[model samples]
Every structure is written in structure tokens, then in C-alpha cells.
Target: MQPVQMTPAERAALERLVEHARGDTGQSRRVADFLLAWWNAGQCGSYDLTTAWGVDDTIMDDMCVVFRLASRANSYPETLGCGPQFEAIVRAWRPKLVE
Candidate 1:
């Protein structure tokens, strides 16, 4: 599916809504930024996401939400296509650091 192109204003409004819906905390914001950067870097794959969290899945869902929203805003096809991959990663996420 072709991503709807959002105007700058629309994009900002959606971003604000997402940020607010996700708690709008410092850590949330930082995680959102990190995901955006990672997506922009053309990075993907279950292994990459797993390593990115370092086995601590505390914020996995929230990060996935941020990633989805950012993907829509930027029309990133790869990230958008990875919904199932993201879910799988979240499902298998470990609660503590992997040794």
C-alpha cells in the first residue's frame, strides 16, 4: 500500500499525538528518536532489533509504536513491512539482559 503523504503540519500533529499517547517522557522521546534514526539508517532484521534492546524488553511495545508512527510519517516501506517481524521480536523478548 502506498503511504499517505502527510503535510508538514499534519506530520507534526500526528507526531505530537503519538508522543503524548506514549507518555511523552524523556525516555520515550529518546527511544522514538533512536528508532527514527535506526529506520533512516536502512537497518532491519530480527537480529538487529534484538541486539538494539540488549535483551531488556521493558520498552519494546512503546518503541514499536514509535517505530510504526515514524514509518508512516516518513513513508518508510521497510519499517512498515516489518510489523510482523516487530511483533515476533516483542513476543520473544527477554525480560533481562541476555548473558
Candidate 2:
């Protein structure tokens, strides 16, 4: 598990991307949080996220694309979390299955 250690500037940049999801009335926020926590806690097998989160493989992959965008060193924060590119994965996220 690799921890994501970032400088203040990098943290701020991630926050900027996060802001796009605030009050978004979509799955963007939930998915964004899940991916952030996943990365911060060290990425698991991508399939682990799919079953645990109740999202199908294609949907999970879509979320990953947005997460990857926000994670890039020079990504434009405004370009993440919305628009046609994210239409499919931007709905309310399904809850984690309680076993």
C-alpha cells in the first residue's frame, strides 16, 4: 500500500478538484470520496472496489477515469466531476453492500 504524500500545494490542488463535487447532486461526490480514500489508504485490487461499492465493472472504470484526472499533477480541476464525459458515472452512487 503506497501512501499519497503531497506538499501543501498538491493538497490544495486535490482540494480544488474535490470542490467540483460539493453539492453536485450526483454520484460524483460519493465516488470522488471513495476513490480519494482508496488512494489515500493504498489502492486495492480494482475489482475489490467494484464488488464492495456495488458498481459494475464498466461503471467502476468510469469513476476511475475521473479519479485519475483529479490525481494528475497538472490536471485542470474544473475539468473533473462533470459534463458529458462523466454523464454515465455521475449519478447517485450505490451504497456499499452491508454483509
| Top of the candidates by lDDT | 1
Q: Across residues 1-99, which tens digit of lDDT does each residue of candidate 2 receive?
A: 333444555454445444443445434455455543433234211323443365445545555554554565333332333243222223322223211
- Candidate 1 wrongly placed segments (more than 4 Å): 1-33, 36-47, 53-55, 75-99
What's the lDDT for all of these models? 0.43, 0.41
How well does candidate 2 match the true structure in TM-score terms? 0.29
Error of 1 at 70 (Å): 1.1
Residue 60, candidate 2: alpha-carbon lDDT? 55
Model 2 pairs in collision: 27-91
Each prediction's total of clashing residue pairs, residues at least 3 apart in sequence or on different chains, is 0, 1
lDDT of candidate 1 over 1-99, digit per residue (tens): 666555555445434533432444544444433543434344322224533453225455545555566656565424335444333322333212222
* lDDT value, candidate 1, whole model: 0.43
